[model samples]
Target: MGTPHSRRGNTRQRIQDVALGLFSERGYEKTSLREIAEKLEVTKAALYYHFKTKEDIVISLSQDLCGPIDELIAWAGTQPRTLATKQEVIRRYSESLRASEPFFRFMQENQAAVRDLAIGDSFKERMHALFGLLREPEAELTDQVRCITALFSMHAGMFALQDVEGDPEEKRKAILEVATELVTAANPPNRRPVRPDSAQTASP
Candidate 1:
């Protein structure tokens, strides 16, 4: 038999998954705790044992998504700010977005709800922190724009390519490749590691 904690954890995950699906299918405002309980085939009391309200469930989902991002930011902070570091940040961020694609879809669809919620402000703050990590301190204006665009392109690509017929992972790789190129271009030549081939062709 599973431990009580493990069972509770499973129930909590089920509630969150079901609630997000309902929120996506119906609008966030239209979805309710009772309906979530109904979808999960659980009683109101059982659902309430994990989440008290729709807002709580949304907040929990946001926190779950934010956790990986927060860790990524912290990890980047410790690394030397180089082209490799920025590219890795982009790569890890893409993976994180993929993992939380459902929550992102919810946020994109429910703009008003996201704006009214605490998660909105929190997400904005995290994005600012990530932007700080991606751009160089004394970069030219164009490079700065490249860094910002690189960050948002991942978000845009997620929805923009939905109608296109292709493997999802390939689309993700295409987005990541573009993002990586942007960051690489944003970095000053001095900041980029010299390739052996480029080294051979040096003017010096």
Candidate 2:
């Protein structure tokens, strides 16, 4: 049997999962806390014990999505500016969003509700921070586009690849591959010219 604390944790995650699905299906404004409780087969009192309101649920979910991104941003800030770091940032960002794909869909379908809530603004700020880390200050316009495109491609892939065939993980990898390629293209390695041989007299 699970401990009381584990049970409470499970209930909270279950609530979040159901609420996100309900929000995605019926739109955030149309979904109610009662409906969420009913869907979870839990009493309203039980639901209230975890989340007080619909807005709170959304905020919790958004925070879950942003937490890792915030960590990534902080880590990137301390790293030396290099191509490998940018690629790893892209890679980690992709991994972070894997579990939040449904949240992305919710945001897409409920743009007005998202705008009304703080989630949109907070998410945008994180995205901007990620973009800043992806591109250098003196990058050319085309390179800048590459960096932005890489991020958006991952965003787009969650929905865009829905109709495509193959495993979800495979599709995710494909998207990551493309995004990584874009990042690499945006930050190509510097090529050092080869120095002429100074002691080639014997060879000649």
Candidate 3:
């Protein structure tokens, strides 16, 4: 039912999946491009055609996560800097992480490797971009903290609360709820008016 291009895309995705599996099972340092090739039942050259190295595979996999984030930041930019927009940003951001659960867990366990890959710093920059979207230009330090904490709760909810008792979906909802409350508090109607000109917070 799919076209040739679609099927080729599927092959690329399969290679990415097998690579992540190898990366997760064996440590990042332990996994090799050859092992990933073996697991995928492909030639080392074929795998190389798809990805040059382990770092390339890791970057490719996380690129899936990055796309939604860039989209969210872009979408939030077009919105009025209202409490509702901040809440919507939180909601969209949570949705973005839905597929990154495993990759994020790997990140926590492999902070050194992740740092080496330079992903951690890029991720922090994204968080700061989101913070810029959420915080008023003249926001007080306390409100700024609230906005930052709101973003933190959303991110930490995934990895930090993995062992918690409730359902994963429920936990996500709770985190969104908490984030929304914080954003709302930070932008009180009597105080922080939605910045009309801030519709586009930052350029792509």
TM per candidate comes to: 0.87, 0.85, 0.84
What digit string (tens of lDDT, one per residue) describes model 3 on residues 40-157? 7889999888788788878876777578888889888877777778888988888877656667667766777888896778877888999998898788999999999998887787
Candidate 1 deviation (Cα RMSD): 7.3
Selected candidate, larger lDDT, 1 vs 3: 1
lDDT of 1 at 11: 76
Which candidate comes out best when scored by lDDT?
1
Q: Residue 195, candidate 1: how far off, in angstroms?
A: 22
**Model 1's lDDT to the true fold?**
0.86
- Model 1 per-residue lDDT tens digits across residues 1-204: 222344356777778788888998898999888899888889999988888888899998888766899999989887777788888999999999898898888888888988998889998999999999899768899999999999999999999999999999999999999999999899965875434255357899
Give me the overall lDDT of model 3: 0.79
Per-residue error for 3 in candidate 2, Å, reads: 18
| Per-residue error (Å), model 2, residue 22 | 0.7
Better of 1 and 2 by TM-score: 1
**Candidate 3's TM-score:** 0.84
The residue pairs found clashing in candidate 1 are: none
Residue pairs with backbone overlap in model 3: none
